[model samples]
Target: MFDRFKERTPVRDSLTFLEPNPMRILILLFITIATYAFAKEKMFGNGSLPAFLKHFDTNSDDLIDEEERQAIRDLRAKLREKRRTSIDLDQDGEISENEVSMARAALREQIEQRRLQKFSSIAGEDDLISREEYTTIPGVRNLPDFIFDAVWRRLDTDESGYISPEEFLSRLLKH
Candidate 1:
């Protein structure tokens, strides 16, 4: 058995061109990185200021009007307020560093509890939900198949063919 292994080493070494060439590996790495960059650019919508200006410049006059500029400022303020609200879980208008994680966890827990309640209502006495059971649930059955499938699969995090109450609750809780 040892001799068989030893013989294969020489055979592998003799095939010099078949060996993984560093230059080829480097080229493949470069291609993979380039592909990733390209994909990310396409997948994430452009957020560049010029793109934003183009989008909001409705009149096509090559310049934004005072009203348009005000709209932009309002949009920026709204976004800022949204960020503050998200980080300030208690709605206290401020977010201290210590409260950051606690706030996040609190928000996630609240959302999870709501999801669990919904799942429990549909799960009946089984305490576990399969995809079919989920699709056939009265409130959910009305949803189109594609939409329901996507939501169900997302909740079935472990992909173990069922969604436990815990799994349903934590599916998108983020913590």
Candidate 2:
């Protein structure tokens, strides 16, 4: 038995037999990366026109009429005033460079704190925001579910059926 075992030749060369096909491995990697890149582009590319129109077209018309345009202008004015008030740290009418810097820091901190608070309230014990839970957000509650579903999809980048704190905060902060 021992003699027979010793006499047997090696089953091919170890290096050749164990080596993976480099071309196949490279092709697989390329395909995976290309698929991921294409998906990301499709999800985030210039597909926001529908959402924009839905938000501004208050009368449910596809086109934004003069009245709708004026509403948008008014909203913008209100937002500008709010931002100006926040930036003016000293409660003065004018914003100085120092005040701007201070306001920037303060705003960042406040935003972070508020985001965490909101996420905590929305996510609750599960620590994940489902579609229903997402809709419950203050400003979001007013929007129709169909309209906001697009926004939810974009925010849920992983497509995991729920929004994590990181995803919620990062996406909201971007806008």
Q: For residues 63-110, could you state the per-residue lDDT of candidate 1 as single tens digits?
A: 788988998779978987887787876777878886788877787788
The C-alpha local distance difference test score for the whole of candidate 1 amounts to 0.76
lDDT of 2 at 172: 84
**The candidate that achieves the highest TM-score relative to the unseen native structure:** 2
Model 1 clash pairs are none
Compared with the true structure, all predictions reach lDDT values of: 0.76, 0.80
lDDT of 2 by residue, 1-175 (tens): 5786545366544445456887568767977886676665447665433454478887775677899889977997898799889888788799999988998889899989998898999899999999889878788988877779889888898999999989988898888
Q: At residue 105, what lDDT does model 2 achieve?
A: 87
| Candidate no. 2 TM-score | 0.41
RMSD of each: 15.8, 21.4
